[model samples]
Target: MTPQMRHRLVHAGWLAAALAALGGVFVLYVHPDFLVTLVDQVWSCF
Candidate 1:
């Protein structure tokens, strides 16, 4: 892969991880129902 592609892939992976972490926090502190909703939202993008 090209350098630009590699960088973009890494960035995307980090973004996905960050979103998942946020979802975990919401599920822990706000509402458990958000966990499934957020995960499904994330997966639906791809």
Candidate 2:
């Protein structure tokens, strides 16, 4: 493959990862209870 194509593929992969992360954040914002539960579970380990 050409260098340009490889570069584009890498960029697209990064974009997809960023979008997925943003979506996860949006879900947490939409349902704060989920985040609270997650934090609670983590704190319980202490």
Q: Pick the candidate with the highest TM-score.
A: 2
Global lDDT scores for all candidate models: 0.89, 0.99
Residue lDDT tens for model 2, 1-46: 9999999999999999999999999999999999999999999999
- CA deviation > 4 Å runs, candidate 1: 31-46
Per-residue alpha-carbon lDDT of model 1 for 1-46, expressed as tens digits?
Answer: 9999999999999999999999878767777567778789999999
Residue clash pairs of candidate 2: none
Candidate number of the best lDDT: 2
Cα RMSDs, all models = 9.0, 0.5
Q: Which 10-residue window of candidate 1 scores lowest in summed lDDT?
A: 26-35
| Cα TM-score of candidate 1 | 0.63
For model 1, name the residue pairs that clash: none
